[model samples]
Target chain A: MDHFILMDAGLGNFVVFVVGPIFVGFVIGALYLIIKSIVVIRRELKNEKASDNENNEQIK
Target chain B: MEILIYLIEGCIGAGMLFIAVKFTILIESPIIISGGVTENKKYIASINSITNVIFNVVLVFISFYKWPVSSILWYIIAEFLLIPFSEILAYRAISKASVKQIIKITYCANLLSFVAGSLFVFILIALLGLF
Candidate 1:
């Protein structure tokens, strides 16, 4: 029983050490990209609206 | 010794962040910007974001492949704090913020994240030793 417990602990640690960082990194990277996309879309919308307003003023 | 270790880790964290930011600015941002003015902004943004996410994931995997201490919780905390930096950079890129302003903001964010992340890592490593 003691040997089994030790083996399990070692395996768990190995998995965490090998896999955890990659998983975390991937999550952070995806998040950054998604946020960047939102910013770009919002800015584009603002610019479009500004252009539209300028066009209306010219017509008037 | 602890302080020295912390200081070195902090600098490493900061350098890593700066490099990531620079990579995003120079490579990923350009691809997103290549969409012409007449293109649907929403569509472009969606595609760009998806593509960039994929790119970043690959980069991250490579970065952490052989790195020490794969503590997910600590990494998550550090990254969550760093998320705002990327968001701010993205906003600035889209708004065409002055280059100097962008650089300043990036530097400040990098510094902040480095300190926070380094401290977190230090505590985490110590805690791991206890376990």
Candidate 2:
């Protein structure tokens, strides 16, 4: 268990009550960015594969 | 009226869980376990939200009727001990992250939620004061 009492109560409270939520929001935003990147990468792979098939058919 | 209040609190609890978990997973390795990370997050968050709401209500009732503990002691137990412990276990069961990673995520995420919840209640109290 965390001994929050022995620590600096004022500073801990300030961090948790003031800065904490903002940090959480930033992390959540980064998670969304990860999702966006994944979607983009998948789309790029699909497009590349489609183009590859087109070239192969044309060559035949 | 109490039912409406419970419904509102339940929504708030679920929303808080969703927001907290959405972020906490990024605190460590952004593990993409062959897709469906989002699905897992939703599943875990739903379980957590329900548990949290019920636990809080029980805590409140316990502090009043059953146990009758002091405010400070109750706060310490609920915030420092029980809630975080439960969250850690919940994350561990559902999350594929390492033990260290899950611990960090749960603690930090709970801190974030504590801050937000305090502000939320403060706002609600303030709004009530106006009326």
Candidate 3:
């Protein structure tokens, strides 16, 4: 059998390949989520400020 | 020696979980706040974010325990399942669902994924102990 398959056959190789990548992917995915959220939050805050300014101008 | 490995594993596991939860919250926050959804939906999203953080912490704890290869396979499976599951839950919660429905679905999905991930880690450790 190939090395990868052999590794899969045993638990140790499985941990290094399968578990390791999954954890790494999870971390990356999480980081992506955080960055995306921050951008969205900033946009929303800007919109809120603009709307507030519009209302004030209308009153004046 | 094992202790050192366990410690390192614990740190990495916890760090990953923290990052994941933080990212999820950041991704969903704007959607919940600006979607003009009901207050209930907003509240549910907030609760889901908090729960996700807590769940990741628990996963970190489990990962720290150390496990054999057979069990590690299960952990890998659990981790894979959580990725899409969490995304769907967040999407649904922040979207058009009624507050009640959002709460039920988010909670169920998050809890299920968390438990599965934790169990997989736990089982890996247990199986390793057998050898």
Q: What are the models' TM-scores?
A: 0.36, 0.44, 0.37
B1-131 in candidate 1: lDDT tens per residue? 75565455445544454454444344334333342212344534443354435444554565566553444543454344444355445445344446565555544544454455467658888999999
> Order the candidates by lDDT, highest first — what do you get?
3, 2, 1
TM-score of decoy 1: 0.36
Clashes of 2: 0
lDDT of 2 at B76: 62
Q: Write the per-residue lDDT of candidate 2 for residues A1-60, one digit (tens) a residue.
A: 266664778788767654455445443444444455446545644655687689899999
Which is the winner by lDDT between candidate 1 and candidate 3? 3
Clashing residue pairs in candidate 3, if any? A11-B69, A34-B23, A37-B26, B71-B124
Model 3, total clashes: 4
RMSD of 2: 16.5
Residue by residue across B9-81, what tens digits does model 3's lDDT show?
A: 6557556666555555555445444543333433434444444643454454465666445446544554445
lDDT of 2 by residue, B3-119 (tens): 565455445544554554444334212332222222344434443444444445455445665454554466567666786776666555545567776666556656666676668
True-structure lDDT of candidate 2: 0.53
Q: Any runs in candidate 3 off by more than 4 Å, and if so which?
A: A1-9, B1-58, B61-131
Q: In angstroms, how far off is B92's CA in candidate 1?
A: 4.3
User: Going through the candidates in order, what fraction of the true interface contacts does each contain?
Assistant: 0.18, 0.00, 0.04
- TM-score pick, better of 2 and 3: 2
